[model samples]
Target: MSGIYIHIPFCKQACHYCNFHFSTSLRLKDEMINAICKEITLRKNYLANNILNSIYFGGGTPSLMNADDLSKIFETINKYFQWSPESEITLEANPDDVDNKKLKIFKTYGINRLSIGIQSFFDADLKWMNRAHNSKEALDSIKVAQGEGFSNISIDLIYGSPTTSDDMWKKNIELALESDVPHISSYCLTVEEKTALFHQIQHKKTTAPDLERANIQFDALIKSLTSAGFDHYEISNFAKKHHIAIHNTNYWKGQSYLGIGPSAHSYNGQSRSWNVANNKKYIDSINKEILPIETEFLTPSIRYNEYIMTGLRTMWGVNSDEISVLGDMYRVHFLSNIVKEIDSGLVHICDDQYVLTERGKYFADRIAMNLFFVN
Candidate 1:
């Protein structure tokens, strides 16, 4: 099965640490929606399978769009692709943008899942991140969404922020547990280049995230969440039984998906492509019936490395049999490289699947790099 990701490139305000393609202005909202629908039609045949297991509305903040905007896009998608009652339709929302009316509207559009961007539960942390929502809104949003019957909800939380003390971080996790969402995606604060947070750190205006502190918090997060019956399914994701994110899990499992809108990426098993990051350029191209995308065909070596990179970051781990399908040389390279990791207790084999140990989780990327099939 395949999936589609629709990018809504508009936000009410910019977060301090975000570098994703987005416009804070709503000047081109109507035009952008038209362009997105057009692009959806233009790339109808991109996914080999016409049946979609999932459709994700990601952002900038999908909740910023009105019901009419969502309806238009949904109509366009329905005209081109097919999804059933069991299919997962997700919308990424901000706390401030959520209300009973909006929640009902989203439910009417068949959005079975809501991934709320609740980065922190403290007012200080919210201000530090320049998020559009405050601490109270964060909790209220979850309560309201739950009240509206959005059981398959996930919340994004950021740890290791300069403004979040250990106590605050613990409180955040505790509050999240109390809120009782089925899935949680958490990440450590990283200052990406060209972001306000990076500039602040470079100018010594604010402190950078402390790695040691982050490590401790990560341990706390794992202990707290796992104890609460959440599976650490992916490196950055935890889910209750049967509640894993189908769209994102498909990505980790090397499934093909089509991404629409500015700065969106698509992979179709053999190659990868991404749309132009500029909203105006994307709209202009789609208006002219042209796809503003760059494509890169994946070499066997590249594909193998990608599998290794993504596979290791999940509970599914890398499969020896799958590696053999790439080529004998790749299998040889993997076998040779993995021995050292296995010997070091960083990885272990269970029925030929090289799964990471708890300690290895800390060095997931590094381990993947070490095991790469260098040409």
Candidate 2:
């Protein structure tokens, strides 16, 4: 099953920790949309299969777009590709952008899933993150979407912020559970370089996220959500039965996908490509009927490492049979290195799959790196 990801590079305000490519001004919104449609037409045959199982509208904030903008894009998509009624269609939204009228418009456009950004349900945490929406809006957005009949919904929450104490973090999870969202994606606050949070940390204006505190909160998140009948499907994602995110699950499972718009990335098993991140350059190049993309063909070692990295972070785990297909040497290397992890109680073997233990999830990246087949 293949998927399509559309990046909308416009936002109303900048979050302190965001490093995504976007513009606060909507000056080029129309041109950007036109370029996106044209690019979709140009790359119509990029994916081998014309049938899409999922279509995700990710970004700077897809909810910022109106009905007309979405209509034009959907029209182009329908003109080229095919999807059944069961196809998962998701849109990333900010709480402030969701209202009764906007939700109705989104529903009219065939958006079945909503991934709302509700980082925290506290005014102080929202202020710290420089989020545009307040606590009330964050809570109300989900209710409003539910009221509008969006049952397959997900909400994002951030833990490990300095302003969020252990109690506050627990409260955030409790509030999210009370909202009855089928899925929740919670991430630890990281200070990426070039983001305002990084600058603040560098200048000693704010404290960096405490690793110990973050781990504690992660454990709490797992315990609370699991007790409430949510599956820890992915390290940072939890969902009730049959509610896992198909689009993101496809990505982790290394399925093919096509990406539309500037700064989007695509993968087709053998290679990966990403479009030029600059909005103006992307628009100009698309206007000239050129794809502003850079491609990289993956080597066996790189593919092996990538699989190990992504596979270990999920509940499904990594299959030894799949590793053996990469090459005999890769299988040997993985088996030899993974013994220590299993012996140390960080990983376990179950029916020819290597799955991370509860202790290992905290060090998933490091463990994956240890098992990497570096060239």
How much lDDT does candidate 2 score?
Answer: 0.95
Q: Lowest-scoring 10 consecutive residues by lDDT in candidate 1? A: 366-375
Residue 97 C-alpha lDDT in model 1: 94
- lDDT tens digits, residue span 170-254, model 1: 9999999999999999999998999999999999999999999998899999999999999998889999999999999999999
Q: lDDT per model, in order?
A: 0.95, 0.95
Off by over 4 Å in 2: none
Q: lDDT tens string, model 2, 297-363?
A: 9999999999999999999999988999899999999999999999999999899889999888998
Q: Which parts of model 1 are misplaced by more than 4 Å?
A: none
- What's the count of clashing pairs in each model shown? 0, 0
